[model samples]
Target: MRKLLKILSREWFLAGMLLAVAIASAAPNLGRSGGLLHIDELSDWGIFTIFFLHGIGLSTEKLKQGFSRWPVHLIVQTFTFVLFPLLFIALDALIGRHLPPDLRLGFCYLCVLPSTVSSSVAMTSIARGNVAAAIFNATLSTLLGVVATPLLVRLLLGSSGAGISLGATMLNIATMLLLPFVIGQLLRPVFGKWFAHFKSTTNAIDRGVILLLVFGAFSNSVADGLWTRHGPGLIAMTLIGATVILAIVLGLTRTAAKLCGFSPEDEIATVFCGSKKTLASGVPMAKLLFGAHPALGVIVLPIMFYHQIQLFVCSILAQRYAARS
Candidate 1:
């Protein structure tokens, strides 16, 4: 068990394999059951556990330090809430004509979603940037997204069948995401010391829970014949499109951050934290906002591909910055 854990820790391939297993397990229900598994409750519980653990792991001091610079926060906020969606809308005008209507709408809808929590922090830390700032920005982004993403989608894609009930989505996020996080924060005084002692255990559990959620999501995707829908050309185009968006956003955010008088560290955080989206946030939101359409899956496909691509590229960029520092 320790060896397996070590392997999974060292490489994400093990996580991918585990997810594939989950997909295989759900294969028998294809076509008849519509890709949803009975284990959805377990997955939801895992998501809740991860959220709580994340809240507990946060250091208030770190957040305070990050928010010390108001300009940095504003830049990140604009990138996440404004710049991202504008890019999607531009894509809609430019290339959307050739794309399927649902796919185009899904693409636009994805742009309005929030930043991820764990990876944003990790990437910032890797870049030797303001890790604390990244954490705060991502946390706030997710919290804001519970409202903002849906509201933006409703306004932009409402006519395109983006069935977003903003109130219900906010309630869902509050219950499944924010509520546990706040509870953990409230319990921090009593649990902080013990939490510090077992920090490694907590991190392990966090990783495991994330893997479970990933598996559950991918299982549903596979069961719905996701892999069979797109051929190599579309996949390649989607991947290339994601890379372009990543590069464009990173460059634009970096320039804006520098112009805003942020230091190099804050600049890195702003660029990475601002420019990226996540499958963790995008997938479920897609289902909620756009229904179980194939185009919604396609929309999420670019985002997920963009996510991994951004991680890999930004990891290299972060290492470069760290070396320079």
Candidate 2:
């Protein structure tokens, strides 16, 4: 209890996340879509701002340096698209009879999600890890997910040629994330020094955006009956399942990083990038993959659980890495 208190006081960001979840649960109608604050647009801009700052903070040379780390890239992608999905499939095979069909599909969706772009890079940056490499792998994962996620769904979920016509989604990604990043890269020579000098300020903004995202997610979860309707037993099952999967993935990534003889920085990147699955990408893709399935909300329930769990766990892990540095 004392240790938990010490951590809460020390890592206020994580504490803030808890508070955000509490607030969202208490007033689900307030922060959710069509609510008063209308967090969707705010969250969209927040994402844009974070990536733009990432651009300014990253040096061109560092980008060049990390671009060709093919081994690191390969490992991160393989763990994301291959190992994670395989483990989920294996679990489904083992105990799928006990799992609800909706919940089973939800977990499978969580498994195949791309590594989240913002949080993956955010956590890596917070950990004082290889931010450049993180940016590369995360961005690549998201872009590739447009194809890979659906293809995997067809192969694993046994769908027949369900193509996601995400021309608009791709555009949104470019405008919200990639375009700002490119602009930041272009303006780096001018504001790079300013960003470096006030690095803590940018870090604070990133953390704030993370909190906003947490609030929005929890708010949506509540409005969608993630807690109120799911009942305690199923909620407990989701939490436990997500926890077990996260732990196994974290352990596997850490072990793989060490075996590859990666530097501490690369190891940090590997563990974070490999362990993450992007909820931002997952939710929309879920709709496309299983459209009008009356139980779509239930099918996405596992994603909600995993997203919250990963952020909480990684925040602690990142802080520990920061302390070590």
Candidate 3:
């Protein structure tokens, strides 16, 4: 019982997610209504701010050091961008007929997302891993994802009737995600100290923005009869699918780290960083990528589920690793 409570306390953000979903289900109109404070516009600006702060927090020196560890970086990047997506595609091929089209696409979307930044670093630190490498890889993955995610979606889901326009999607990502990240990096020299001083505030902003995105996406889903269109069975299947994917990725990353002769610290970093996906980036990307589609909410469900699952599982793994270290 104590262990369960500790786990829950550590993962309060997951509870917030549930609350967001419930509120959206009850009053989805709050997210959809347009006024001076439009939710869509707010979500857009929130995404920009999120990446901008991410930029401010990065250390160029650490990033360079992380780059120097080319072998580990390459492995993490390859798994995040290439291997994960192929695994999902294979999963889709095997079980695609059994699942709804939207859910299948959601699985693919979850695969393409970058490794999460804050959580990946936090878990790596907890596990006594190479924190600098975690930071660099996570940051670089987000930047790459701004381009790679959209392109991969176009290639993987274009024929699934998602109506993805590769050019328009790239334009949206570049303007909304990449441009702010670059501006933040440029301004970091001036505001870096201030950003560090208010680290807690920036962290809050990150969680707040994600919750807002969640509320908006789920509200849109609820408004579109998400519950009626898909029964509890499909929801269960998505949960199961997310769990299985995480397990497979975790096993593969650990095995790959061992075979590649990574140090224990580097191995832990690779396992935690490579196995996780970023809901922070995924939500905003979904809005830009699939906003017009009817199943936008459904499309992001797998990512949402996977985020919580990875946190819970990685928390346990981190604890174990720390004990060994």
Candidate 4:
């Protein structure tokens, strides 16, 4: 019991996410209803603040130092951008007809997403890995995803009759994601010290924003009658699929890191960073990408489940790595 409590304390964010999902399921009106503050508007601001704080937390010098290890960066990016999507595409080809169309698309969307920023860094730190390299690679993945995700969706899902407009999707990403990130980066020089001084506070805000985003997303999903469409059997299949994808990616990353002769720290960073997909980024991107598609909620469901699975699984792996270290 004490051990479980300790694990729970370490993974409070995961608990918060589950609670958020429950609340969204039970009382979605809280997030879906508009009054003084609309959930959509709040989520928009939360995303902006999340990225802005991310910018403030970054150190330019450390980023440059991390960049010097190009081989590690190359491997991480290759797994994130290339290997992940291809794996999902192959899976879709085999079992695509078996699953609901939206869920299959969700799996594909999950693959194309970038590695998460804050969580990847946090997990790397927990594992006693190359923290600087994690930050650099995760950040770069986000920037690259703004363009790459749309293109990949077009190339892969174009035939599904999703009517994806590459130009409009790109515009949305630039406006909602890239623009805020750039603004945050520009302000970093002035606010970097203040941000560093209150690191814990900023980290709390990061988690809070993520929770808010999750709540709002699930609220939207519930409002659209997500449960009616996705029955127990479908949910179970999604869980199984997400787990398999994660296992494959984790194994591939570990093997690749070893083959590349990475130091233990770099190997840890590569494996953790390379295996993650950002629900924070993926949710909003889905909103923009699939705007008003009846299946938008369904499309993000895989990523939602995948996010929790990765966190729980990686937390255990991180703890094990820390013990060894």
Among the numbered candidates, top lDDT falls to 3
lDDT of 2 at 193: 84
Q: Which residue pairs in candidate 4 collide? A: none
Q: Which stretches of candidate 1 lie over 4 Å from their true place?
A: 1-9, 13-37, 197-201, 207-228, 287-299
TM-score of each: 0.85, 0.71, 0.94, 0.89
Error of 1 at 238 (Å): 2.1
Q: RMSD of each candidate?
A: 3.6, 5.0, 2.5, 2.6
Model 3 stretches with alpha carbons more than 4 Å out: 1-11, 33-37
Q: Rate the local accuracy (lDDT) of all candidates.
A: 0.71, 0.78, 0.87, 0.84
> Any runs in candidate 2 off by more than 4 Å, and if so which?
1-9, 100-106, 116-164, 254-272, 277-325
Q: By the TM-score metric, which is better: model 1 or model 3?
A: 3
By TM-score, the better pick of 1 and 4 is 4
Tens digit per residue, CA lDDT, model 2, 60-172? 77656678877889999999999988998899888877976667777877888889877888899999999889888987887677667766766676642244334554555
lDDT of 1 at 288: 47
lDDT at 185, model 3: 87
* Candidate 1 lDDT over residue span 1-325, tens digit each: 9998887778764466355545544562431224345444565676677678777777777778778777777888898899888898787778878765545665676688888877888878877888888988988898788788878877777566445667886787678777888988888878877889887787677666545444544455555555666446666767777787888898999889878888888998898889878666665555545444434445566776777788788888888888873
In the range 1-325, model 3's lDDT, one tens digit per residue, is 9998897787667878888888888887887535223678889889999888887787877787777777888999999999998998899889988988788888889999999988999999999999889989999898899789988887777676357778888898988888888898899889988879998888889889989888887777788788888879877998999999999999999999999999999999899989999998999888888875657778899999998889889999999999993
Which window of 10 residues has the lowest lDDT sum in candidate 4? 31-40
Clashes of each: 0, 0, 0, 0
Look at candidate 1 and give me any clashing residue pairs.
Answer: none
